[model samples]
Target: MNSGMDPHSEISRNLRAVYQEVESEEIPAHFLDLLEQLDAAERSQSKKDTE
Candidate 1:
């Protein structure tokens, strides 16, 4: 059943708008610190696996 408007296009437009809004926001400092901690843990694990 065609509704005369493409639902897929409407969804794509909404998703793009949401993405643009999110991209403009600043990341919190605490979140950045957490991410850095995670990266360090991953690197430590990788070094252990190689040895």
Candidate 2:
């Protein structure tokens, strides 16, 4: 919600910030899979709520 950041871009930025903090060897494939699922669920829930 900063001056130049749109919601989509802001989400991307936040994801990059989190990714940077994680160790490469410690990263799990399921983490990315779950992130995507969670993101989708959030979007779906928001859409449902708005309606």
Candidate 3:
């Protein structure tokens, strides 16, 4: 197996496959809500520090 495939090409193909699989996944709504909460907290902290 993989006798004639260039090593670089093989690596590239594998990476693309993995990327596609990850890209097709659905992010949970709770994860998105958590991210929003984190952003809000960071902004609040930044504002307090500046004042």
lDDT per residue, candidate 1, 1-51, as tens digits? Answer: 975666479787898789989888899889999999999999999999999
lDDT of each: 0.89, 0.83, 0.90
What is candidate 3's lDDT per residue for 2-38, written digit by digit as tens? 6676747878789888998988889989999999999
Question: Using TM-score as the measure, what is the rank order of every candidate, best first?
Answer: 3, 1, 2
The 10 consecutive residues of candidate 3 with the worst lDDT sum are 1-10
Clashes per prediction?
Answer: 0, 0, 0
Q: Model 2, 1-51: lDDT tens per residue?
A: 568657478797797778777745676889999999999999999999999
Residue-level error in angstroms, candidate 3, position 6? 8.1
Error of 3 at 9 (Å): 12
Model 2 poorest ten-residue lDDT run: 1-10
Which candidate, 1 or 2, has the higher TM-score? 1
Error of 3 at 3 (Å): 9.8
Which of the predicted structures, 2 or 3, would earn the higher lDDT when compared with the native? 3
